[model samples]
Target chain A: MNLKELYQEIILEHGKNPRNLRKTEDFNKDAKGNNPLCGDNVHVYLKLNGQKIVEDISFEGSGCAISMASASIMTDLIKGKNEHEAKEIVEDFLGMIKENPELMSENLDEDEKTKLMSLSGVKQYPMRVKCATLSWHTLISAFDENKEEVKTEN
Target chain B: MNINQIKKEFPIFDEKIQNNDLVYLDSANSSQKPKVVVDRINEFYTKQFSNVGRSVHYLAVAATNLYENTRTSVQKYINAKDKNEIVFTKGATEALNLVANTLGQSYLQEGDEVLITELEHHSNYVPWHFLRKSKNIKINFAEINEEGEITLEEIEKKITPKTRLISITHLSNVTGAILPVKEITQLAHSKGIIVVVDGCQGAPHLKLDMQELDCDFYAISCHKMYGPTGLGVLYGKKKWLEELPPYQGGGGMINEVKKDRISYGELPNKYEAGTMATAQVIAFDQSIKFLESIGIENVMKHEADLVEYGQELLQKNNSVKLIGNPKNKGGVLSFVIEGVHPHDIATILDEDGVAIRAGHHCCQILHDKLNIPASARASVGIYNTKEDLDQLNESINNCKKIFNL
Candidate 1:
């Protein structure tokens, strides 16, 4: 409902020039997600080391500002964390976008929480909550090695 | 009738949409129902609600007559050769599926080709795709020119000796390109190809004449024509409708059933099985009358003028790129901002109570051909005005400001 809150300065900047928007070299896991309603799509790639620590995370897709910026900021914060930390952050972000007021994961620092909170404006726009969560869900699919494509219909 | 006066007939305009006057520009998605059509539904339910074509009760007989009257009205409206040619289905999707399924059962052979264009909606293409999977029929696409039009020549070039049917849209919902349906139908008929039209976008905006266009089958969405939902009209040549197998089998569509064999009812009833959308079908007669009262020619002119004005306004605005520039266009105005995604633009515009569509508009093939994920579209109806387009432009500016464009 509030345009200023929805399209914040940081969101706009990240959407225009998305970060880590490329296929990670030697990625071990990847998954594709699509919003069939709007035709927005995302392909999440992850490169995890032998120790199961995240070495690289990136995405390749086109979408609305909320989606692109969410994916860009997600990859930026999730690159160095281990698999457990990355999954916890994903759950916390999805929770906040769904209903919770704030992030609830101990794995994420205050700066990381603040960066993710900018996308909380999507909660008011129920049709767009899928836009903010598609990449996160796809990243989870990548981690689990689920080959089925994720479809965000709700 | 004046556009302002026409707008008053739709009661939704009187109510504030989020504290702003509703600038509804999504008619291509579905049109707003007039007071007459809405009140007809209420009146039918309140006073004369009865299941049609059933018992010998007074209301059932009256309701049956009323239902058949609407069928006659549709026949006259589309200028079909026989009233039996017009069959009511659940929706345009169901109508098109009925054609594809019946033809696949009786007429189409394995390895035969069904030609469709890039401008077809998923409803037009997906049903034929079922034939591809089950019957192994080949589906060919007629390419679109740079102007986003599916020309008659494109149809000609795609036709082979194996081509058995050609299905296409009467108007592109995304590009606003009005396909040359009449000429294409003529060409397809010359080559003995069946032409089925997805008239969801065309029925509401263009003047329809089945006898003149001479297409073998045309599917119309009633909701898009200011009628109620859950009802659609399919106009097929009587011979084809009689010859093709029945789509759905139920109580109404049956002539008789035995352990050994079953007989189906006649033309229209065979297509319409079970209980129909009784209230919606009865109410749709008023929608046809509403169009007749205003006259389709005037409606066409008003929408054409609005699209022209909207096109010029957006073309003058910086960073706004209108989608297609076909010589013959409809009421659609699709565009993309250089630095803004269509979803962002649509959300920002919705805040100003400018309701437009932002998506593939069910034409993913056309969007893929255009090489963009999605685009925003603002389509007009009989009630839309130049001031509505002006409000749309102002909202687009607000979106640009929010995106820092």
Candidate 2:
């Protein structure tokens, strides 16, 4: 209910001054995603060194604090992980948003779960779920190297 | 005028939103349906659901009678000279597009010009925009004044010998500025130019007498006037409707299909291509009756009072910037507050169980003209009360304070 606390200093800092907020020109994989309903756009870049992702992600976009912060944290979480682990993390994050807390708690610890709980607040506002998960969905779309186009309407 | 009595007619007013009474100020987007309209629709499906004008059965005859009864009701509602002149369309958007595609193709040529105002909605603007592009015709916009009012002088400047048609909104969706349609139509007619009036907003609030205004065509949406969605009325002059070709080619629109050639149906049916929304059309009669019972003049007066009250309340707050002219405005009040986006304002208002519209309002051209990305609008309807306006003002003030504007 406290939107100010929900968009805390950490979230605001990540939103205003996000880390890894750059387009990778020489990257092997990239995908552009947009929440057309709210005019949010994210360009995700992935650097895959064989099966192991040397640097899985970064993104540049304009959106609300939740979307930007979620993108920022998601990039940090999957940076040095393998493609399978990254996919699992993505699925787990999506399950959390879709309100499968058990699935979310299975993957993340208590402190990390509290941080992800900020996104759970978006469930109260059904209209804003897309704003919170736009970048995460974009990251999921980027996992497929051969499939260039991925558009989901949730 | 009797708030409690009028409130009883609408079932949604009785429903609570977030433990509070719903103050629906988004009527300009879509008005809430009255029980009469709802009951009529329910009755149609429950008793007499059948395809109209197709069979010799009793149900078909009854359905056909009800469907044509709506056309007559629309004719009387708008004061059209002939009932047959009115054609049922999906909505005003489709109605406007039908004119642009059918009449624009027949009348407009490569060097011809179409004069439109800057305040037109996307439905009114884009159809002509597409026509201009496809036919290589010129599309010119008349300038809007500082108060967002389009003047006769500005329209006169835009019109030329090459101007084949002049189209404009009867009342601006954003500004609520009532254009002088009579003068505009007379001027267009003087120049041998046809006129098309987008009456989607105007038809809902005002008594439209097509004989008096004498425009070549006028388009209206039923949903905006408390009627069901997917049913609209397009009132065209008989000569113009006859001259313009049918917009879409389909089954019911044709009278005879030969091996190599086909003959189209008569006036109204020629334009009506596919299976119409029969229940909605029947329900449209009840909406028209509902408006007729209360009377449009009284409704307009009530709405004007609300608009004036809203203007006074909104202007008292320094942070809130009213968008349109204060004087001679319709029921719509579009505004923007400092330091808060219209989208954020809408979200906060929604939390308080107050619904208002935010965005371009399907008038991207007007937004671009005003040099604003978006605006928030609260439009009045028959069901709305002064308390609703007060709640809206209070919520907007709350939004300003919350955003520290």
Candidate 3:
């Protein structure tokens, strides 16, 4: 119920100047996602090595503080993880954001888990859950080489 | 009219939204219902519910008469020439689709152009776009000026020899631009072009006179007019309604149904196919009565004053930018904060129990032209006051403060 829970300091900071907020040149994987309700859109780009380890990840989009910060933190932490570990972390994050009290992925370190937990505030606002999860869904789409644009409503 | 007394007629203000008074500024999207309108729906369902125009039984006759009474009320309210000119539709979107579909079937031809404005909502553009795919008609857009107003000159410029129709909004939902519809209609008529006015925003705020405007077809959204959802009125010219083909083929709209051949019914019945929104159509009479209680002149004045006050408040705030500067505007006040997104603005404002719409307001072309993804909007209705605008300004200040702007 508190506005403070939704718009924390770290969110405002990262939303103001998001990390890796650019197009990754020579990117092997990319996908677009948008929340048609509010015109929020994210284009997530990833460069994966031969072993399917993520070497770099970046995003380009405009949205609310929750979305920008969520995308910022996601691209920051997803840089070094392989495809399987990253997908597990995404599943863990989605689970934590839905009903789980804590993130359950061992692939994430204590510090990485702490950063992702800040987005748990979106769970209280059901309408805002899409803003937080848009890029993560787009990341999955990118890995699968799905050409369809990610829609939160779908 | 006393605003506080008039506000009390709506029971929603009595309820608390998150322990705060509901400051509703989303009337452009849909207005809150008055108690009489709500009670009328309850009364109809409880006592007078029946399928209209079919059975000769007591309840059916009474229900049909009540349904017909709303049609008369709408005819008088909008000052239409004939009551049959007003066809009940599901919503303004459906009304528009009916016009486009029926007109496409009968009047328009392949390669004919239908001129519209960039200020149109998706409802106005998308339906016509369907014709483009099917009939191969080209859709031309009358560009908005720097102030966002669609001038008569601009419409005149867009009308080529092949232009057969011109569909425009009476008022832009986002920019608050009131198009020069009457003049444009006159010009289009002279050029042998049909004019359809998307009057969704116009019917509730502006004066509705089909005789005066003289547009061929005008769409009205009842829910935006403080009436129930699932009901709208399509005010078409008698000639157009008669000449155009039926939008949908179903029970009541048919004059005769044989195995091989069939004939459609006359005027309004031809359009009112299938079982209609009986309860909503009946209850919308109360909405008309409610609006009549407070005159349209009074409604316009009060809303204009609120928009002016809100505009000044937002303009004075640092880093807050108003979207359009139309000289003649509506109650809509859309703006963007330098560092804050509209969704962020809406969420922060809601914390103070101030409700507003954030998005393109369903005008993506305008937003794409404005080069912003979305903007926050605060639109006023009859229940809204200067105090509500003050609250909106204060909430914007709080949102800015939170964003460290």
Report the lDDT tens digits of candidate 2 across residue range A16-58.
5667888776677777787644445788899888766646478
Question: Retained native contacts per candidate, as fractions?
Answer: 0.93, 0.00, 0.86
lDDT of 1 by residue, B8-117 (tens): 99999999998999999999999999999999999999999899997999999999999999999999888899999999999999999999999999999999999999
Off by over 4 Å in 3: none
Interface RMSD for each of the candidates: 0.8, 3.6, 0.7
Off by over 4 Å in 1: none
Q: List ranges where model 2 is wrong by over 4 Å.
A: A1-35, A39-92, A102-116, A135-152, B400-405
What DockQ does every candidate get?
0.88, 0.18, 0.89
Query: Model 1 over residues A21-51: C-alpha lDDT tens digits?
Result: 9999899999999999999999999999998
Worst lDDT window (10 residues) for model 1 chain B?
B1-10
In terms of DockQ, the best-performing candidate is: 3
Pairs clashing within candidate 3: none
Give fnat (model 3).
0.86
lDDT of 3 by residue, B309-349 (tens): 88899899898999899999998999999899999999999
lDDT of 2: 0.83
